[model samples]
Target: MYPSSLFQALLLSATLVPNVFAQSSTTTDPTQRAELALSALQIWYNAGSGLWNTCGWWNSANVMTMVSNLAKHDSGNAQLVNLATRIFANTIVQAPAKNPQPGVESQSATKRSNGNETYDLFNSTGKESGYYKMIGEDAEPITIFPKDWDKAEYIDVKNLPIMQPKEQVTTVAASNPNDWLDGFYDDDLWWALGWIGAYDVTKDTQYLTLAEGIFKAVTKAWPTACGNGGIWWSWQKDYMNAIANELFLSTAAHLANRVQDSDKAFYVDWAKRELDWFTNSGMINERGTINDGLTNDCKNNNRTTWSYNQGVILGGLVELNKASPDATYLPLAARIAKAAISELSDSDGVMHDACGPLCGGDASQFKGIFARNLQILHDAAPDAAYVKSIQANAGSIWDNNRDEGNMLSINWAGPFIAPANASTHSSSMDALVAAISVN
Candidate 1:
């Protein structure tokens, strides 16, 4: 972790300094912009956890992937390569410590079964000595029940027993210490892709093996009930969301290309199977963009058309096209990319999420996913529009959406917001790296 005092000093200097990049004309260069964005991002890095602070489990994978992409894009820069190498090594060692099983006690009271008894913990009124609802730091409600009802013991809310329902316990055992598997299949998929990207840039067999292990672990959650296809979003198998399935397809296709020919057919087959299911899954609406996930009846939920939802599938299709040499994959990816740019971009052609200005933690990471994946598709089949969109967004992020400290905001187009953290910075870093790649 960086020293808090020094970090604050840097932020203070960022505010006082009139354009920190003004000393050099290279400031306008895409590569230099990416380097500056990276420096700002590292300020939030927690070396002990092998993860960036202020972001959730999956976002760290994207952060790692972004760094790896920069390493690849600026391979001639030995300093950048060395920084990427150190980050890869440190994260592999420290990230596992952050992974843990989601315990039963963390489950919400409403999710638990209690003989049809409804506990409106958020609104229930009680006497001074009776049970009361207390809000947790995450804004979730906690019901503090009296420990000894017979004794009429008036225990404080902090000392009282938390109400829990009777249900089967959820336990997750890691395959190995290095395994970064979590309760969410999507989280594992993100790390798998991150490690694969690392392996691509570094040619480290260990990273490849780690990614393979993650892919294997996630395959166990492939649901047969969802018309005998698609990976579940989590171990609970409650929702088969777009991100999880998109990552599954991308991981499988990427592995197929990287693995040896004898083992190649297995991954290719899985990739093709996943693509078939996802294309027919009804999640992709007529607009060529995807919704969140399916409803209970396996119909389109028609949820928000998130940028990442459009973005991740582009990468998956690009990889599958490479692995299987399908003529249609690239065109399909192009259609989705075009639709996303048309739907998500503002009058100025800068991308923004439906819940913009404050897209919260997760959605803040969405637009960058689109930017990078669109670059992938553009690399496969060159498009002037894709390049224009990327350059425009990158320009906006640097000129309009960034703070004096070189930190990026969730909004790519406009005034900078306060409290920009790892998710927002890394997501914008994706745009910078993509711009460099396209150039």
Candidate 2:
């Protein structure tokens, strides 16, 4: 059960004055710090929308995963479990309508009218024409357009072509009533992993089944053109990125471990196939850290070594190791984790992204992903360095990176910046939760 009085006090104090709570300082205990961080995150929760404010669709998925991690770590806390259950239930019902708000859809339609092709792959004609473009927004919903349509004439914003609706699966009460799918494949995979994490904590078949549904949805995007392997990042098929493929591998391997049927082998094969392709795909650079994605020629783009690109693969490899028990999987994950720590952290061992100071919403969520997955890998194979790094980062987040409201900044190293949001709070929550687990 929740410590209602203490929680209410913290909320009240956060509401009253910013510096008061900061002056008093937060608890040094990792578990208590995690609990406080979770409470701070709730300030952004829009119960009506079933999503947090100031973050995108995919960021909410990471938020859910973060909460589920805390609930899993603190299983005895009935409040945490109940909170997870409520979020899982509400988000599936409310997010579809609220996420791609009417304005976002309008903006996407407007972009389409300007000869910016935005096609939904779920639509057969849209897939064939391949004239789609994603709007310049984070995880914006895809609007399908008819083939051979008049590019010159303004599109009827009111009558945009809707993508094919997802088939309703009866077993899961948390089924998305909207039957809506986003434009980005990585967005869907994040939700898949979120539901999987929720299932891990709650043992709820609905969540697991929902994850399976999401996984099945993404499986449709496995490209026949990209050398007959790897999932594309979006319906646009612009380029194959590390994050999407990492998500693909992780989701498959996770399902393989959770599902008990003939489908298990199918997932196992897919995970193995993805791993085989990913290992040879040239995304993992010479430093053993992953780059952003492949080039148009299917080579490593050698982009910024984003913390998330390094993080998700750790959890994926751990899951793959669980599914197949490969001798190389865990060690490979450890090496990458070590490399990421070496390359991404500062002299004081605090994690920092390449796009710091103002990493924006998406990048704000990146470091915590690295931290959370590092804990996953550590759970499989205990590493002293991983534990030390996790602890140090968690310490800095509370000591140097948080405000009076306990909201965290994008820079985990120090000097809490103003205007923190769900993305940063939940990202830091990932580190706090990881610290609790390893400590």
Backbone N/Cα/C clashes per model: 0, 1
Best by lDDT: 1
Off by over 4 Å in 2: 1-26, 99-172, 176-180
At residue 316, what lDDT does model 1 achieve? 90
Please give, for residues 129-220, the per-residue lDDT of candidate 2 as tens digits. Answer: 33233422433223333353212222111112121122212223567412435556787789889889878876878788888887887776
- Candidate 1, residue 89: Cα displacement in angstroms equals 0.6
**Tens digits of per-residue lDDT for model 1 on 1-439?**
3344445434432332235556323377788788877767766666556677777667889999999998899898765675566667667765675554322112322222224332211121221233323323432223343354212122111111120221311221223523576556777888999988888877777788788888887776665345668876655555667888999999999999998889899999989999999999998899998888887568887778889999999989998898899888998898899998999899888998877878766778989999989999999899999999999999989888887668898889978888799999999989999999777
lDDT, model 1, position 26: 38
Give per-model CA RMSD. Answer: 11.8, 9.9
